[model samples]
Target: MWSTKQLADLAGTTTKAIRYYHRAQLLDEPERGHNGYKQYRAQHLLQLLRIRRLTELGLSPASAASALENDNSSELYEALTAAERELTAAIDKFNAMREDVRGALAGRSFGDLALQLSDKPPGLSEKDFAVLLVMSRLFDAETVLTFQEILHSSPRTPVDEAFDALSPNADRKEREAVAEMLAEQTRTRTPENPPYSTRGQGLAEAVEIMEKSIAHLYNDAQIEAIRRSWELLRAQKTASDT
Candidate 1:
């Protein structure tokens, strides 16, 4: 028979741990003797040693206790299997977060011109980055990759700068001129009309979200100019096809 302190020291744990185990119903408390000191038996020492061994094996305190309580070997195996699955899921989540951080550090670039005209283009504002973030959620990785390539090969001209500088309150004549210029540029730059791929739905959704974001970031006149430019470009394409 040994005292609580002696059992704790022999088991390589503290007295506080023994008391916690008692409260957790993991350890059986010994009865008080005539001198008012609790007497711990060999069984108590063995249980404490078992708990320390289980903890060394990476079993949580609760799992260790529950595994010890199971008399059947199969039940213990089940508990350990569940712990393994939880660890794997945690590892996967961490890996995904690490990849996202690496991407941020690498610089997802855009330009002052249209998104299609810049892979690592300069003059991207914080608002433009915000739109890309939204777009990233709506589109898949492949579509965005292709879009970036298209932008990288695009030619930069003075007209692109004019559209970028266009004010929200631009007059009708100014809007029309910008839109017509943009349409002509689109026609000259992208002469080949490839069939839109099925993957385009994701890009379309992302573009819609980006347009909404642009509405909040740019003034009404700028937004109108952009809308009119796309419309005129589509009409020009239709006319050429006929």
Candidate 2:
């Protein structure tokens, strides 16, 4: 039998911790001497060594003490392996997304333009962007990836230039030219999943907000040009519906 201090020295822990372990019922109560000091024997040393071993293997103190009985050591090993696999998958996906962002910056031009155009407040409202973000959530990963590819197309004409250019004082002819060009461009590359698709035929509120934000960007004559082109677009849609 060894004294508490001797046991603490041998086990690399404090006598107080040994006492606490006994209180926790993890270490069995040792025998007491004539003077009433507790004496720990070989059994206590072996149990503590086992506790340290299991602690090194990621088990809690209680689990470490009782691991032989609970069958959790193998389970912990498998859980660690599963977690590693998930982390690897996440890392690979992040790397792939980074490559796409790099490619879209130059190779996939329109996609980059959309991001640039969206940099200003009310230029491409966060609410509108939020609607686009929601569609990505609703679609499958492949569909969302395809939609991203569609955004990379270059602007087809001078109106695309005006729409993207950030000048508030663009003339009526310039704005109208852009409106006509955008209408033709939009007709050519109509999205299979439009932001307004979820709203179906009832897109008045969404269109109003978008149009209002855009209207505030240009002068009175520019507004008339834009309004006429938009009316032409509405007429085309109405004729198509019939």
Give candidate 2's TM-score: 0.33
> How well is each residue in 118-221 modelled by candidate 1, as lDDT tens digits?
23245544444434433433455444444445445676688888888888778999988988887777667653763233324553554454566446556777
Indicate which candidate wins on lDDT.
Answer: 1
Clashes of each: 1, 4
**Ten residues in sequence with the least summed lDDT for candidate 2:** 112-121
Off by over 4 Å in 2: 1-149, 154-158, 191-195, 199-201, 212-230
lDDT of each: 0.59, 0.51
Q: Model 1's lDDT to the true fold?
A: 0.59
